[model samples]
Target: MKNEFKGLIVQGDKKFSIKNAKTDYTGGYNKEKAKDALVNSKIEIDHLQEKLYASGTYSLLIIFQAMDAAGKDSAIEHVMSGLNPQGCQVFSFKVPTSEEYEHDFLWRHYKALPERGRIGIHNRSHYENVLVCKVHPEYILSENIPGFTDIKKINKDFWKQRYQSIRNFEEHLTANGTVILKFFLNVSKDEQKQRFLDRIEDPTKNWKFSSGDIKERALWDDYMKAYEDAINETSTADSPWHIIPADKKWFARLAISEIIEDKLKSLNIKFPVLDELEQSKLAETKNILLTE
Candidate 1:
């Protein structure tokens, strides 16, 4: 099943198509089965994260990019609930503020990188510069890049530079022992409409609904093209992208947790081994405590 999920990985060697990606995939998995699998995956993730923290050699950066109401928040909450918060940092990138706008796009994101021995989760990350701003080029103007007084200057070369910048950024992190897992939650347009309707019809979820969401839905195709291009341009062997089938939240959560577990196991991190002196000290301390 995990290997099947690997099919969702956007291979840089191949031509990526967002339209062909699965959104409502269950792989014959029912909700109960997925939930049971998720429980096991979470337990393993907790143990693996402990090894990562105890070893303090590598960091894990999990990035989530998706359309509006595509379950990024819920996926983060559920799949990551088992992690030790002390060794985990989660940052949600909303619209950039005046201060964030002052620097290069990656500046704020770089500051949020997880230190070795921890897991960092970014909800809607640096990819937004390419995904959102690609659809609406005007947003790039707010960055105030010199020589870009007109939208005409923000042409193909400009986007190419941005994608290259992202690749360089991830490559540097991987070189420095940060394992990157990028997920693009693939939710069908019909599924998104149902979610929006749920948010509207249920009083408890009304806060989640916004008129802007409807406006964005109108540009679904544009966002898809942006996402397809962004994934193709940035995905690499080091920083892999998983296009999760997000229409079924349970399956998506299970798949993501399993993928994360697989990556962590591949790292083969273990608790730091103490030297002979430290080991003797542990024995002496235990003896003293027992005598007391």
Candidate 2:
């Protein structure tokens, strides 16, 4: 199932175009079918996560990036539903705080990385520095970077440098036992409009809508270009990007679970073996407990 979506995974300096991508793909899968698959995936993920936690051999870092109303939150909530809370950490990055701006863009992300045996999820991650900031170059001024007093001086090279930095960062993590899985939820513009309308019409979902989302929607094309470039530049064999067709939330969730399970399986994770002495100690403890 994971291989079925390899086309969705950006690779090898490919020229990516959001216009050429699909946002409602289901690969002949229906919602009911996808839900069943998701249930199985959740069960396996629960078991794999237990082994991953107990083995203490590797960590998983899942990064989600998408436009507003693209279902990043729900996807994370559902696909990670069965994970142990003790082995999972989720962080949603909004605007950079004053203290965050004090350091480099990737600093906070590095600090938030999962420890060995845990899974860390980033709702909107370090990729924002290149995506949103690229779309709105004016946002660069807020970073307080050295020698950039003039925002207009921020040139194409600035973005290139950031992309290189991101690639280096991911490679470093991969070398140190963290498996990186990046998902770009590719929701269509019309679908986004409909979702926005749903949020407006549904009183319970009112809090999810924001005027700022509308403002950002106005720059949809620019954002798409930014995503294309960023995905193309940073997606490597070690930390590849999966451009998920997110209009159909059920399919998207199922695809995400499949991809996650595939990665976990590839890690060959297993529970740690007890030494002979440890096994003897365990037997002694069991005898004592039974006698008690």
Candidate 3:
């Protein structure tokens, strides 16, 4: 049934097209069915998170990337609401500061990674170096990396190196017990327009609307191309990208939750068990506590 959801996972060498992917995908899906599934998934997620926390053997890293008005914030909020805050950490990355730029692109992201028995959520993440910086290459000049004085000199090879860097970084993480789940919220341009309009019309949501978003919207095609290239380059058996349909926010949330739950389940995590000696000590401690 999960296979029926096309464009859900980007497999090997698949050249993804943002236009061909369906945003409002409700071919045979029912709202009630989705709601029920989401409810169950949330409960399972809460349970799995407890196991994950107690096992202290593996960590999960969830990465979300999308264009403006793609509902990244809402998706994280809804899907992760049930998880314990101590076990889950969320980081939203913006433009790099002078201090950040001094280090490598993935430096800050490395610092934010969750330890064993935890979940780390990257709202925007290190991919911004490839997506936003790819669209506007001039931003790279600000980094002042060695041997790149001219923005015009930064060509495809430059971005290619960045892609390789990202792939290597993710591979390293996966090799060391970090399970990576990358989600690209595939929101259509039309849906985004409606969302932007809603933000403008709703007085409370006006703060969410920014003029810069409109400017970025103009480069929708460019951004899509960048995303396509990045996903294609980085997706692997260890860490794959899921192009989630974000037109229907509910469906997106449900899908995200299911993926997360499934990944955690695959880990086969279990709480530590006490040995015979430890059990004996524990029983003695329990009897002492009862007497008290």
Candidate 4:
């Protein structure tokens, strides 16, 4: 983790209260500084990713979770600007399709994971099963889960079990050389309302506004508690969650890219070196080319 932004992390033994977390932090950086920082981080990431691909020893899985208008899309677009497309995979999860609903919640996500030496990004990930479904237990009925048709049965115990499943799933991934980083774009209700209004007022952004968004906004408190519980429950040492201050979109992108660079730097990945046999073969090939 970056030294300046270390306080934002809520993982393992760190207790979290979303109500107390900040919605805007620039980490002493102004807009110009933050933009410069983001660009530098992207450059570092480009070199690091090439080394990662050559080494092929590890993979990175980054998860983003947030309320509407929290800037998840923009953050991804900016922070990942210079990365090679072939080494990166981005998945945006919406409502589950019929086929997806037929399987375990983690099945599709597990299949979408990056192969060795690549990075996988989830705009909204498996956490949805616990967050959104926790907010609306009725949605669980659609999955046709055994003994879960009754909303009454979707009790505290059911959520605890889901959290356990997530922990186990991440544990399995980490043990197999996949590093996980989860981020929650913590935006304030006031800020969100302003953003929603901006969307409605601007003709270009009018399509972003939907009546369903307002319906979800009405349940903001419920969603907050759901996020609080999900973050506290699933965050582990290996798979940590960072509660990003997202009210300032530029700062959010800066912080995210910095954290990513910090993690990749920790890996100390390097390009592969040829062995003696390969070196001799290369020399022979060079001699043949020279003769030609």
lDDT of 1 by residue, 1-292 (tens): 3666778777678768887887988877899999999999999999999999999999999999999889999999999998899999999999999999999999999999999999999999999999989999999999999999899999999999999999999999999999999999999999999999999999999999999999889999999999988998988988878889999999999889989999999998879999999999999999999999
Clashes (backbone N, CA, C under 3 Å), per candidate, total 0, 0, 0, 0
Q: Model 4 compared with the native: what TM-score?
A: 0.98
Q: What are the runs in model 3 whose C-alpha is more than 4 Å off? A: none
**lDDT measured at residue 107 in model 4 versus the true structure, 0 to 100:** 88
Clashing pairs in 2: none
Put down candidate 4 lDDT per residue, 1-292, tens digits, no spaces: 6667999898889878998998987789899999998898899999999998889999999999999999999999999979999999999999999999999999889989999999999999999999889888999999898888789999999999999999999999999999898999999999999999999999999998898999999999999999999999988888889999999999999999988989999999989999999999999999999999
lDDT tens string, model 2, 18-120?
8999998897889999999899999999999999999998999999999999999999999998999999999999898899999989999999999999999
lDDT of each: 0.93, 0.92, 0.90, 0.92
Clashing pairs in 4: none
TM-score of each: 0.98, 0.97, 0.97, 0.98
TM-score: which is higher, 2 or 4?
4
Model 4 C-alpha lDDT versus the unseen true structure: 0.92
RMSD of 4: 1.0
